[model samples]
Target: MNGAGTKRRIGIGIVGCGGIAQSHAAALKRLEQAGECTVVGCADLVEEKAKGLAEKFELPSWYADARRLIDRPDVEAITVCTNPPFHVPATLMAAERGKHTIVEKPMTMDLAEADRAIEATRKANVRFGVIFMRRFWPGAQRARKAIDDGKLGDRLILGDCILKWTRRQAYYRDPWRGTWAGENGAALVNQAVHALDMFLWLMAPAGQLETVYGKWANLTHPYIEAEDNAVAALRWANGALGVLSVSISTDPQLGARITVTGDKGATVSVTEHPEGRFGLNDVWTIPGEEEEMGRLYERELQEGREHFKPFPIAHFWQLQDFLAAIREGRDPLVTGEEGRRSIELIEAIRLSTESGAEVKLPLRTSTWVPPTRR
Candidate 1:
């Protein structure tokens, strides 16, 4: 069995029981029945919480500590779903045991932790992938291809990524929801990470961003340790630049979204709603090739409907790629290093906000924190 558990009997372990864990379990459930995987066990700080998830998903066992679970002889792979601070250790520990890993985004809220995760996976020679599942977006891929083909014409990176979402006090009602140490920073890391990934994915092959200037404030929720909203200006090496905006205190809690612009034309938006019908969709206006682009897009749209069936099957694509990479011994779509870039950039934005200067890319990672409870 393989990483998903059966036919290849790859043992699987989960290390967190937070809200996102449910989605992970559901996806695992479907994967297992299809003979793509099996869940040997799951773990969390709270044993019963992990027990509950295992029971719901019908996993064979559960543990209070991830280390114990990873140490299990049966486990061949692990999913680290713990909060920001604990992500590094959980991931590194599993990798050290020579097991494959699937880490949640912003891997950690800081560059140092992210770097460590990247290096550990590389050194361990295991299949490591980041969960920026937005890459699976149908429209995102379409937009990326158009950009690569120069359909946008001498395009400057992107002018701005306007992410206007609404979240009320209730969303942050849980104290852990908005703390610097707990959730890391607010809008940029938590909310904008998805947007930022899509931002960079479309702008690939361009030089890494060299400078970042950010302005942030507590905004509506002063009780929280992190900013409720933030905006950062990004300068790519090619002199092309972009701006990002995020807020968690807005009204109505609008779903996550991104809008990109170029010199020739624009694709108004990109969103990642794994449960949604259109895993990815795009609306674009190619400068001199509108007719051809539209026709192609229409065909893609029709095909997308047939492929993205309604179910909690979003991660199947990402998980399949990881499994294939593990089987083939290669890097998956989002490598550990590629995954860490977003965190590095986010850190630069945070630092720029704190230091009042534009930080450069390939930024140094210092003041690293190992996973530990406050």
Candidate 2:
């Protein structure tokens, strides 16, 4: 419905059958049942993984090579759930075939690959999107609206993003888990990326960011090569200051949250406690609406619980948007360009860490890579 205009169900294909791919498959299963889309096939470098996902979801086909799955005549769109290294390549494959593509977060390891992915999709004239599913959360939407509506006042004073979560040493048993070439940077690029994207999106009204200075270290998890903790300070063109603190070493895991304060002396926050759950407005102080905070939070928390009981509704909602965009000939909410912004921020942080100097916005293209660690 939703302006889809009675068209046939879109055929969907998936690349990379990892843990995240399972979530996508489960979400696609629901869409298939609703007659909105059908899972045509799935693929992974490991034959067993590809076969297992296909058998689990009862998808029509499975392939050991992503290109084979992308070649399927029925698949009109594909979701790339591969490792960071494969994201751009798989997107290029899908774009070459005129298939719409939606990639997982941290669009690419660096800005150059991000630009290439954007250009390829643009030149091919196909829709390209990144999976920032949390953006669909009710609280995140509300926070954005508050800023846009001036409820938080004219000039934003501060933006804070905090993500403190635990990952046991065993979690890195997989050879690729913490490697720069495999998962990219650990805490900031993989775990904290969702919150960081939300922070950037919420602060868009504050004008462009001017500079970033960052520090990172493998404070714990000696078994891994990537940083387990990182922090960055940022300044925006509008003179707003921001801080990002992320770590995978917290023992009890504090979860993820983003808070913003405006010159109106009002502050608001959206939090995802225990992680992976729907976010709720944990803090709201918008003049007359102060009293409604508790009620609104409780209501949304219960709704999120009920909605997510079926499947990860955030992924479902975002996938629905991608499919609807295809049907309506419009761009998905998280376009390749929108996704590129988060990667740019991550890159700036890394550059700052290496150079021990503040990095400026709209970073110039470079072949810089993180130093190898064992």
Best by TM-score: 2
Question: In model 1, which regions exceed 4 Å deviation?
Answer: 1-9, 154-156, 253-257, 261-268, 271-282, 287-310, 366-374
Candidate 1 local lDDT, 304-351, one digit each (tens): 566555444456677766766776788989888778777777777767
Clashes of each: 14, 0
lDDT of 2 at 301: 88
TM-score computed on alpha carbons, candidate 2: 0.96
Cα RMSD to the true fold for all candidates: 4.2, 1.8
Over the stretch 37-60, how does candidate 2's per-residue lDDT look in tens digits? 989999999999999999998998
Candidates' TM-scores? Answer: 0.86, 0.96
Residue 147 of model 2 has an lDDT of 90
